[model samples]
Target: MSAFGTLLWLEFRKQGTFAMGMLMVVAGWSLLLRQFFAWGAEPSIVALAVVASTLMLAGAVVTAYLLWLGLDFAREYRNGRWALLLGAPQPGWLHLSARLLFACGVLTLFAAGMWGTLAFWLGRVGLEWPLGLGLALWAYGLGGVALVVPVLFIGLLVAAYLPARADLLAFLVGLLGLGQLLEWSLRLFSAQFYRWLPPWGLPLPRLGEMAWEGFPGLPSEAFVLLVLLCVLLFSAMSRLWQEVEV
Candidate 1:
């Protein structure tokens, strides 16, 4: 295998079990929610839409995965594994890239599983899949990924910069709290004010709502801008990793 491939495979081996455990938690919650919707009183379309939006815009689920992967990288750094990897032939960017790619793959799978559960619930409740929910779910999942890129990147930064595991945990908590504050602030501000701000004002709930409202294709402009931001963040992270004192 190539260096990048080897690094990616090692990352998967280290984090795959934890990733699976997180997936199982999501699956269990999904099943319970499905049963509640199934056995509980009949739900209106609005209620269903609200629930669907909430499921797609689940920040907690995304944050949990981010923290898991972030701590894994931090653990490597603290345990001297990161220094050993740096001794290898490949550049530091390749190492960071491998972790980022692995994170993207894991998050895509997480979105898929969450969407599949939502679809299953919709099907059991006598809703058609393709015509009723499939396209919207696809759009939401893609948008969700776009929403997650920066977040995961931020997590990586925290892990790489902070020395202690407890510090990493505290940073993540503060980060999540700050994100929630920004989200709320965006909502509270005027639409005109939001338009004046950067794309960060456009939160996941808005993206999910657009999907639910049948906006076609990917949110192309937002996705492209986010991809660019991820690239910038990745470059910065690579530089930081190289400069860190062991």
Candidate 2:
């Protein structure tokens, strides 16, 4: 395998089990949801149940992945693997990229799966959600998930460099500060910068009376700004990664 591939494999070897377990739990929840749907007498009620359940699932998955992402590097500090990675010839970005890619890939799978699952359940109830809308939602969700990776990675690095026990507090504080900065930056984008950029609208299939006509699209600059912000955060993370002792 190539060096990047090797790093990806190493990440899998470290956290693959947890990822698999998480997937299984989601699968089990899907089955349970199916069973619950079968119990609903009203079509509208069952459809509402499906929508609410899907949202709940999405929120749970996001939260779980957040913890998982933070732990990806934090766990290494305790398990003696940190020394091995510090000794490797790979650059710090390679290591960070591998984890970021892995985590993002997992969430992508999750979003796709949930979208398909909702389509299936909704089909059974004679309601159809648009593919365009699903894709839009998936992109929006995955973007949120992917963007936080840099913050979490930096938090892990901060925690690792601190004394034990105290590290937890340091990590949370770092995340809070970074998160606040991100919020402020986004506010600025919304207040002034967003208007300067073109609107990136979603194209929905016209289903006659069922078509959505008035949903405003997001500014293209919102996405560009997010990408730039993540790049900045990841760059800072790379610099901090080298400071961790072997």
Candidate 3:
């Protein structure tokens, strides 16, 4: 395998147990919806149940993946493996790119799968395509990665600076959990305040409002903005990594 492939594969191996657990959780949710249908409901009620179940699945999957990505970055830093990898033959950007690909690929799969299931269920409910939901879901998943990338970067920096109170691993993981708190607080602020920021300002409103009709979905300009922001933040992160002292 190439360097990128090797790194991604290693990360994938580490994630197998978590992935299996999530799969079981999804299966259980599917069973619960099935149970609701078996309880003898009208078609309309069944359709409602399915939509509710699908939304629940999407919410859980997104939250879990974000937390997992944050924790994973912190764990690598705590173990000193991040520094070790950076010292190796691979470039820092390559290493980070691999990690980002792994994160985005896994979370995107979960998000897409949940929405695909929803699309199937809606079809059964006699609903048609262009329900104007799928693109919003896709953008939300991509935009989510864009938002979390900086969190992971900042979490690693914080972990490196903090003292080893408990195990480094424990402290690092806890630092990553701090991202969830950051996310919650950001939601409390209005977008009018946040839009000045690059990444969070872009995704937050679209994800919350499901407004696929405007800049993000319809206009190619939004796509350009998203790409530019990702590149800028990623470059800043690389510079920080390079400047970190051993």
Candidate 4:
């Protein structure tokens, strides 16, 4: 196999256990949420709203997974595994790209397992798959990706630049928590200002609201802007990785 293929395979191997654990968590959560809503007599608007809320929760799960993966990489760096991998005869960008691909692959699997479980439960409730469950799943998956890419990029940056793994993990948690606090403060105190601000201004609101109409969707210009942001962040992260001591 080619070098990139080999590295990609290695990345998958490293992540296998964690990925399985996450899949189990997603499955369990999906089943639990389904049971919570299934106690009702029939499907209602509230059920659809619950599905929407679940999608947002799924996005948070995916983001947390990505953060965990990035921190794992940082831990590997501290233990010299990352430097050993960098010693290989391949460009740094190729290695980073392979990691990105691995993340995308794992995320796709996660989304499938999560939405598939949800769909199964919806079917048990007599909902149509294509019209109701499938469409929502697709929207949720797309929105989740749109929400996760920038976070993954940020996590990569933290892992590459932060000298200590503990600091990297703490920074990730604080960053996410601060974003949520800011979003809540903004929404609570200044509704008009929140409406005027861009969709991506705060993480929680961005992830929660962007899946809806009148907010950023995967096909909209906002998504293109997010793609550009990811590219820029990834470039900066790659450069930092090259220059950092670890």
Top lDDT hit = 2
Q: Write the per-residue lDDT of candidate 3 for residues 1-246, one digit (tens) a residue.
A: 798889888878977667666666666665565665575776666766777767777777778777887787677767888668656767667777877787777766665666566666556545443434566666766777786756746654554554544346654664575556455545543334345545422232222223335444333334445576578668866765665544
TM-score for each predicted model, relative to the true structure = 0.59, 0.76, 0.67, 0.59
lDDT tens per residue, model 2, 62-83: 7877777666556766787877
TM-score of decoy 2: 0.76
Query: What ranking of all candidate models by TM-score puts the best one first?
Result: 2, 3, 1, 4
* Cα error, candidate 1, residue 133 (Å): 7.8
Off by over 4 Å in 1: 37-40, 45-58, 128-220, 236-245
The TM-score of candidate 4 is: 0.59
Identify the candidate with maximal TM-score. 2
Better of 3 and 4 by TM-score: 3
Candidate 3 weakest ten by summed lDDT: 200-209
lDDT for residue 186 in candidate 4, whole number 0-100: 47
By lDDT rank, best first, the candidates go 2, 3, 4, 1
lDDT per residue for candidate 4 within 19-125, as digits (tens), equals: 78878887777757755565665464434655676677777777787668657766875797766664566766788788767777777777677667656665555
Clashes of each: 0, 0, 0, 0
Model 3, C-alpha of 191: deviation from truth (Å): 14
Which pairs in model 4 have colliding backbones? none
CA lDDT of every candidate: 0.59, 0.72, 0.63, 0.61
**What is the Å distance of residue 150 in model 3 from its true position?**
1.5
Better of 1 and 4 by lDDT: 4
